[model samples]
Target chain A: MLRYLAKKLITLVALLFFVSITVFAVLFVLPGDPAQIILGINATPEALAALRADLGLDKSFWGQYREWVGNLLAGRSHHSIHYKMPVFDLIVDSLAVTGPMALMAMGFAVLISLPLGIYAARNQNRHGDVTVMFFTQLGLATPEFWFGILLILLLSVQLGWFSAGGFPGWAADPIGAFKALLLPAFALGVIRAAILTRLTRSSMLEVLREDYVRTARAKGLRERSVIYVHALRNALIPVLTIMGLQLGQLLAGAIIIENVYFLPGLGRLVFNAIGQRDLPVVRDIVLFMAAAVVVVNFVIDVAYAYVDPRIKIN
Target chain B: MNTPLLGIEELSVGFDTPEGKARAVDRVSFALERGETLGVVGESGCGKSVTALSILGLVPSPPGVIESGAIRFENSDLIGSPPEALRRIRGRDIAMIFQEPMTSLNPVLPIGRQVAEPLMVHRGLNRKEALDQAAQWLERVKIPDARRRMGDYPHHLSGGMRQRVMIAMAMVCRPKLLIADEPTTALDVTIQAQILALMVGLKQEMGMSLLLITHNLGVVAQMAARVVVMYAGQVVEEAVVSELFGRPFHPYTRGLLRSMPDPAGRPDGGSRRLSEIPGIVPAITEAIVGCKFAGRCPHAFGRCREQAPGLFDIAGGQRARCWLSRFPERRRTDA
Candidate 1:
């Protein structure tokens, strides 16, 4: 098991390395003059050159990469041109807003999807299944941004139930922050819940047809226990895969959602940085997101091993 | 006959398909004495498995409707029992071991948990106690290293081992009637023999009646005392095992017997040709004004094509559904 874990760790490191290099290369390939953007359109070429040197853009590509990787290893922070602060500090500040929202949204998604998905699978081909599936199809097709906008229009503008956009410090007033986050979280979570519901339904349907499920029934277990305990565990492997992938998407997707809500989050920070061509900030955040994805996936893999004894890491 | 552990009277199962209402089991009736082994032999889609499922009320009700039936177990009708009541009776009184052991045992759960599930549900035993009993049952089934192996998942076991685990699971509750549907079909010849022997031993030890559903005549000869031959959703022939093999009155039974490959009757010294049953079994969807096997039976006559023959007693404890058996003069000699 230790050897298997070591092997997985090595593979994870390799994957992170590949992801970092690819992201770095892609960001550089995009046609953008960060120095000119920083200096302003009316600024002279000498000012631009000075800014480029200062930003390490004047250095060789490999030299810059080596310096970036070395600085990351040494915990040397990058300055965010947009925020005029350390990239780390900006990320921490944004995370304070985005982290709880993402967590709460995922929690809501799971709470809504689990029972609905199980119900759809159990009452497969009935009115319940059809209705849930129809809504799920709509959810998967409609983008989160559009859904967010719709929620803002319907619940905030017309209904007067929530604030239009912006995060109130939840620390100062927990109830106010909760009320503020609820609509945005619900908007994002509904789409996720819809996707997860579909996945859970399909996976559970397949699992229910398996011989073990029949065996469970034959064992005189109540229908509920048979469906929930025996069937759900086996079905969860596929659902977990989709959920892990979506977690990465949630982080990336939060950018748009955060922007729409005008919430201060890593997503909005990244979006603002991209618009201003803050390459250092962009590079750092992209790398951080990549790392987050890898770590989340690793946790999911470990969780799978715990849930299914048949899944030996080796 | 010890009040007959299980009795089925006028049992009929029909399904509402896209075509129409198609009867799967048409007025099929049989009795199983306590500790008796009744082998139900049939071709694919011949309603053998459906009959077994019906006994435990496991058949899906909407598509599969019990048109008419009384499945009496321990002097109580199980036909219309509530789902909750059925749950109590299912693993406690009537247990079933399904085909495809690999898929039948939940791949996610440990074999011990699968086996002990019935005990936990019916007996209300906690996990530790249930697991202890499960390990004992595994040992009873001759699974090596039962204690250690209890933690192993279904996929960790071989096909035969998995089937044994399934059998152990079914028998753990000491059900009065154990239904094994093609239990050994997924196994190789050697493992098949071992599993059959193990089932026989377990049945004898527990004094449990067994309803063995299979397409193999050899299995009937080895394990069963009485045999029911099914063809096209009907019981074509039923007789004492020895009598059924000695004198198969139904054409389907005769065809099945003849089709068994005999190693001693090899044309080449080492290889034998399997006797083939010429025509395919008729589809259930086909309109049946006459006998279901009439289209395929070599001994089918004019009346056989026009009128369906009800099961009639041919001799003591032997019944056959065939026009030729009734009127020997009308039997075809061509084949």
Candidate 2:
């Protein structure tokens, strides 16, 4: 198992290296001039040349890439033109906000989806199944942005239950931060819950039909135990697969959600960096996001073996 | 003999399908005495498993309706017992082992837990106590390394081992009656023999009656005292095992016997052109104005095609559902 995990870690590092090169190439190859964009409209060719040299844009493409990669590896400080802060520091700050939000959203999604999905599956062809299925379809059909807007309108604008947008520091005031976080988390989580719930229901329904489930019932176990203990464990493999995939999706979705909610997170940082053509900030955040996704997938792979002993890593 | 342990009188099971209400088991009646093994032999969709499920009230209601029946277990009516009362009876008074051992044992749970579940539910034993009993039952079923293997999941065991776990689960509660629905059908010939032996030994030790449902004549011959031959939702023939084997009255029973390849001799061991019953069993959806097996019986005549034959006694402790049996002349002429 250790050998397998080590191999996976090595592969992940290689994949990250490839992703970094691609991001570098794409940003460098773009037609727009970051230096000109940074400078005012009255800037001359000499000023442009000077600004380009100062930003190391005067170096050859490969040379610039090499220096950027070298500086990152060396932990050399680099300023973000967008935030006017060190790029690494900005990444860390943004991650602090985004990481917890994504995690909370995922937790909320799991808590809501698993039970609802299992219930729907057990009560298949009944009123509960129909109702849950209808809402899940609605969630899958409706975009997360629209859901976020609706939530803002209902909870923030009309109801005045929550602030329209922004994150309060949980360290400063836990109660206030929890209340502030709830709305965005709900907005991001509902869509994810819908996805996971649908997946859970279908997978559970399929697993319930397996022979083992029949055995469980024949064992004279209560219906609840049969559905939850016997059926759900096998069903979770697919649900876990979807959950892992959705974690990455949630991170991507956070970019739009954070922009709408005005949350100070990595998603917003990435968006702001993209707008300002701040390659350093963008590259670092992208790499971090990529790393997060890879790590989550690795964790999910390990969890599979735990959940299902039949899965052996050779 | 002592009053039968289980008696099903005029039992009928119907399902509400989109097409229409379809009868799966029609007036299926049988009795199992204490410590007796009654083998119910039938083809697929002959309502063998349905009958077993109905006996335990495990049949899904609404769609699956027991239109009318009296399932008397030791003179207590189980047909319309409340769910809670039925729950007590299910694993305590009567237990069942299903076909397809792989599908019948919950894969996620340890084999020990699966075996101990009935004990916990009915006996009210805690996990440790129940597990101890489960291990004992596992040993009864001849499962090796019973203590260590108790923690292993169902999928970890072989087909035969899984079935042994199933039997252990069923027998753990020490129920008066045990229903084994094709319990060894999923196993190899050797494993099948082993399972049968384990069941026989356990049945004798516990003095529990058995209702063994199977399509294998060899199993019926070896394990059963009484044989109930079912075809198209009805008992076509029922008799003492030796008598049934010696002289099967119904054409379906005859066909079943004929289909069995002789174990002691080759297929063509001087038996004049091996008997082969022509045609398939009629679909349940088809209206049964006449005998259900009439379409397949060579001796089927005008009366046989026009009216269904009800089960009738032929001799001491033997019965068959066939018009030819009503007329000895017809039987002789046909022969």
Candidate 3:
């Protein structure tokens, strides 16, 4: 198991290395020059050259990559071209928003999916099953941003329960911050819950038919115990895999939902950075999202071995 | 007469398929007296397993439904009992072991927990008390290092060990009746013998009645006192093990014994071919006019094809469902 952990850790580092290189390379190949974008279109050729030199853009790709990676490792962040702030600080701030929102969205997704999925599976091909399937289908069909807008309309505009969009930082007011993220988190959760619910249902339906399930029933276990404890535990194995990937997707892909709520998350930071050609912030945030995905998957792999003892890490 | 430990009367179970309702078990009636081992013998798809499942009321729903029956246990009909009542009876009054030991156990759960569950569910034992008893049961089943092995999952054990675990789980509650559905079918010959001996020993030790379901006649000869032979979801014959083996009444029973490979080989050192009952058992979905086994019976005659014969009493407390069993002169008449 220790060997497995070590192997997984090594794989994570290697993956992050590859993601960093890819993120840096994409920016390198892109048309916009960060120096030109910062200095403006009317800037003299000399000004552009001086800014390029200062930004170390004149260096070879390998040289620049090594410097960028070394600075990141050494905790010396590059300055954001648009914001004129350290790239690391900007990312940290954005993470402060996205991290909690994503985590809350995931919590909602899991809380919603597990029970509904098990319920649908237990009543598979029945009325309850059909009802769950119908709603999940509708949930899957509706986009997250559109759902976010609807929640804002219902809860914010009509109900007067919350502000329409935007974040009240946690330090400023914890309750307000929680209330602010609830709608967006729920919007993200509803769509994700849809996918996860379907997965949970199908996975549970398959496990419920296994011979051990019959054994569980024969043991005189309550139907609740049989379905929830025996069947759900086995079903969660596949659900965990999807959940890991979906979490990664949620962290990186909540860009539109973040925009709909006007919340300044990592996705939003990356979005604005791309438009203004803030290469430093964009590069680091993209790497952060990629790393988040890789790390979540690594955790899930470890969790998978724990969930199914049949899967020996060795 | 004293009440049997478990009595199943006119039990018919059917499964709904895209094709139609496939009758898996048709009006099968049998009884296991207290401390008695009753064997239900048949080829695959002959309803032996279905009969076993029907006893526990564990038959899968949607696909499976009990058409009609009364499973009387301790004077109460389990078939008519509510779900809660049946559940209380299950793993308390009656427990079941399935054929696939490898798949029958919950893979994720520790064997110790699986064995201890019935104690928690029915016996109302606390976790610590249950675990203590579960470890004892594991040791009873002869698991090595029982206390240490408590934390081990199902996959850690070999086929024989897993089956032992299954036995431990089923018998942990000390159920009055243990329904073993081809318990050793998926084991090696040596393992099969070991499991059978273990089961017989445990049944004797607990003074529990056993319902052993198997296609292996030899197993029935070794383990069961009374045996019921089924073909195509119906009982072809039933008799005490000695009478059934010594003077088999039904042609199907006689054919089953004939099919056994002679362990000593041919006397002249010539390799004699073992006999086999030809033709597969009829599918339950097929509506038949007469005896279900007539198509495969060597002595099948016009009456056999025209009219279905019910189980008929014969000498030595045996019952056979064949016209020839009723009239010894029928074979000569056919000749």
Considering every candidate listed, which one attains the maximal lDDT? Answer: 3
The lDDT per prediction is 0.86, 0.85, 0.90
Worst 10 residues of 2 chain B by lDDT: B326-335
> Would you give me the overall lDDT of model 1?
0.86
Query: Cα miss at B272, model 2 (Å)?
Result: 6.0
Error of 3 at B260 (Å): 1.1
**Candidate 3 regions with alpha-carbon error over 4 angstroms:** B266-271, B332-335
Off by over 4 Å in 1: A1-13, A16-18, A25-32, A39-46, A153-162, A170-179, B1-3, B18-21, B264-274, B332-335
* Weakest ten-residue segment in model 2 chain A by summed lDDT: A211-220
Q: Write the per-residue lDDT of candidate 3 for residues A1-314, one digit (tens) a residue.
A: 78977887788789889989999899999898888888889999999999999999999999999999999999898899888899888888888888889899999999999999999998999999999999999999998888899999999999999999888898999999999889999998889999999999999999999999999999999998899888888999999999999888877748899899999888889999999888888888888888788888878888888889898786
Best-matching candidate per TM-score: 3
- Model 2 scores a C-alpha lDDT of 0.85
User: Each candidate's DockQ score against the native complex?
Assistant: 0.72, 0.54, 0.87
lDDT of 3 by residue, B1-335 (tens): 89888888999999998878899998888788999999999889999898888888888898999999899999999899999999998898899999999999999989889999999999999999999999999999899899999999999999999999999999988999999999999999999999999999999999999999999988999999999999888888999999998988888888888898778888899876888889888778888998888898888888899999988889776888899976677654331
lDDT of 3 at B90: 89
* Better-scoring candidate (lDDT), 1 or 2: 1
B1-335: candidate 2 lDDT, tens digit per residue: 67789999999999988878789999999999988999999999999999998988888665799999799988788887887677678878888988888777765567888888888888889999999999998987888989989999877889999888888888888889999999888899999999899999888999999999999999999999999999989998999998999988887888888888775666666654466778887767677888988888877788988988889998977899999888655654453
Candidate 1 lDDT over residue span A167-223, tens digit each: 778788788787777877888889899989999999998898787887888889998
